[model samples]
Target: MLQSFKCEACKSNNQPSVSNHKDNSHLPDCKDEISLNTIGVIKTMFLEKRAVPRQASEAARIISRIELNSRIFNNPEHSLEGLETFSHIWILYYFHRNQIHLKSKVAPPRLGGERVGVFSTRSPHRPCPIGLSLVQLDRIDNGTIYFYGTDMVDGTPVLDIKPYIPQYDVPRKIERQEFFSPREAPDGEENCESVKTASTSTSGNLVSNVTVPNWVTNCKYLSVTFNETAEQQLQELAVEKKSITEILRADPRSVYLRTKYGSQIYTFQLGENTVTCKFDDQNSIVNVLQVRKVVILGDIPVSDDE
Candidate 1:
């Protein structure tokens, strides 16, 4: 005999319960595996997606061009014939600059120090680092499709392009999340009161002849002095932290105290700045000492003097 049950939510009594059902081994594997490289590569001028905006709506009026391969271009017109009617198109591309191994949890810049699940964040580190951008389509001529308001970095490879449909894509009402607040402008504008004119050189460098903003000029710990060994480790840490921290305590060779004289590795975490070096290895420290004025070249790691 078969058993019957009631629906808890609606209080209906027509539903059947499976508490006494016998198991049958007739189910097949449900994994659907698709082959990769099924689609051809899309060559574009964008290289890295980090420089791309977190959302496509943020970028407006930025022009970018997409070119398809000759094979795909043979019938490109047929594939994109009616695409121009749509105001916006969805661009799917690969993130070529993801360095860290794909992780399920990522530290988003907006979250400060908190670690959020990768699915909740728009992190590039995923099973496949694919990016989606809703770009404004300007025109399509031959195999080239010109777009505007693109956030993709120069030389980024595009994967696919699909026209955005308002009827299907637009949401009725979006529930707000805690971290969905708009970004605020920096508070340094108040300090710009004394600023007169800001000019840049032909080489694209800011040539500031006027006095710096009061916020920056009034900083007491602007200049940091460190020994060669300590300076090197600080440089390494600066690259990782992307911010400069003043060194408060001074103890030369403090980082190398753990190891014997020959194999000593010295490192120090000064505020947000971190420096690392090996005993007798002064190459990294020497480079940091040379740039005392500002924390320049923080991205590149230097070898310690050996």
Candidate 2:
């Protein structure tokens, strides 16, 4: 035998009541009861926190504080004792900023900057609003835990914490999919020679195979180009690309400067290697000219004179 229930929030008429038996007289209809205080709140020193990274792995040096409630602090020290050995720790917390219910689809910055399903992408808007992050554990003291490289905002409530075990988590071999590919360089000189020979036999033009830099590999945006000239222009603008990249990578509105183009303040969107600006005036159009004397961080083309 089963019981039928009606929700108080939606009213009895809106929701359907089902019982093991078809007879309505056998089961009485009632509303479902739920408890809201399942999780505890966390306190931190960062109150007016801004420009926080969207992912914890990106910001691996910035320090932040975390405080757990005293009621559930039993064996907290024992739980965190083995965490010092691991390089990274997984933080499971709630997204206090999200106000809407979880949707089936979400707009992800990756996936060619398109909307993906909630299950596929890590969006803040969800039924639980729970956020998970792999952050570096710097130190742990009493009820307060200090972490580095966190995307969580100040005063965010923490649900749980777990040490990241590379042996158990890392797969022995991963099959590449169309959306994601392995970043490691190819092995063996013989294999490389064979590839070069095949390429030479097909076309005379020697195609130089180069590995992509770490900075470019980690970039989320596809439109940006990290050439020398582009970097030089960014440097001339009195902005550091590393720092600017951090700001632009996350929510741009949080990091972008409010500048007066004409009369109104317009926010600029930055790419991995390019900085884009918009004018408030309707008549003005954005354009980019040739760049000169760009700072080259990695392997770049050189002239005969140099």
Per-residue accuracy of model 1 over 123-143 as CA lDDT, tens digit each: 667766787788888998876
* Deviation (Å) of 164 in candidate 1: 1.1
- Across 181-296, the per-residue lDDT of candidate 2 in tens digits comes to 43434432124454445445534322243343343356543122245655667666654445444433343332123222242322232212224433222433322221233233
Candidate 2: stretches off by over 4 Å: 1-50, 74-78, 111-113, 174-245, 249-306
lDDT of 1 at 277: 34
Estimated TM-score per prediction? 0.44, 0.49
Best by TM-score: 2
